[model samples]
Target: MQKVTDYFNKPLNLLPNYFKKIGLGFILASVVFVVSVKISGIHPTAEKKEMMKIISKDVVLLGMMFIAFSKEKDEDELTMLIRMKALASAFVYIVIFKIVSDVFGIIDQELIENKNGYFFQMMIWYFFVYYSAKLLR
Candidate 1:
C-alpha cells in the first residue's frame, strides 16, 4: 500500500489515445453489432438490442459528464448557497407535482399522461429557481 502511494505521488503521463488504445473500441463495436442484429431482426436473439441501447445511452452520458466535469470555475459562498436553495426549491416542486399527480390519479387516471416528462419539467423548474434566486439576490 505504501509503495502504491509513493508511485501515485510521482507525475505520470497517459499514453496517446488511451481510450482508443484500450477496450472502448470493443465496447463501441459491440454496441453497433447488437444494434445491427436487432435491426435485421435475427431470430434466437433474446432482445439483446435493448441492452445495447441502454449501454450506448450510458456511454453517451459518461462522455457528457467528462465534458461537464472538465470545465474549471470558481463559486463564492453566496453563489453556492443560492445553488443549494435552488436545488431545494426544485425538490419542493417535485414533491408538489407528485402530490398533485396522485390527487389527479385518484380523480382520473388519465390526467397525467407521459409521467416521464416530469423529469424534464423538474429540470426546467431547477433553472427557473436558480435564476430567480440570482435575480433576487
Candidate 2:
C-alpha cells in the first residue's frame, strides 16, 4: 500500500512543447478537410460517407492524442490539480447541459442518436474549459 501510494504521488510527466504544436496543426488540418468536403458538395455515396466519417474521427483523435499528451505551462503539482478540477467541472457542466437539452428538447434527436458524438463534443469542450480556467487563475 505504501509503495502504491508513493508511486501514484510522484510528479506529473509532461510531454514536449512540440506535441502541442503538432496537435494544433492536426486540428487545423481536420478543419480544413471538413470545410473542403462541405464546399465540394459531393453526393454522399455510402462508401464516401463512411470514408469521410472515418477521416474526420481519425484527425480529431490524432489531435486529441497529441494535446492530451502535451505539457501544460509550468507542469507541476498545482497544474495537475487544476487540470483534475477542470475535468470535474467540465463533466458536471456537460451533465447539466445534457439534462437541460433533454428536458427542453433543445438538441436534435438524430444528432445524439449515437452517444459517441456527444462524448467527443464534450471532450473538446472540456479542453477548452480547462484552458480557460487555467488562464483565469
Task: Report RMSD (Å) for each prediction in the order shown.
Answer: 9.8, 3.3
Q: Model 2, range 1-137, lDDT digits (tens) per residue? A: 99899888876566786898898898898889888878998678889889888888788878876786677657876667777776787688779867766765645665445555665666777788778777887
- TM-scores of the candidates are 0.47, 0.72
Candidate 2 yields a Cα-based lDDT of 0.75
lDDT of 1 by residue, 45-94 (tens): 34765666566655644443232222114435575567667668878998
Off by over 4 Å in 1: 1-74
Which residue pairs in candidate 1 collide?
none
lDDT of 1: 0.60
lDDT of each: 0.60, 0.75
TM-score between model 2 and native: 0.72
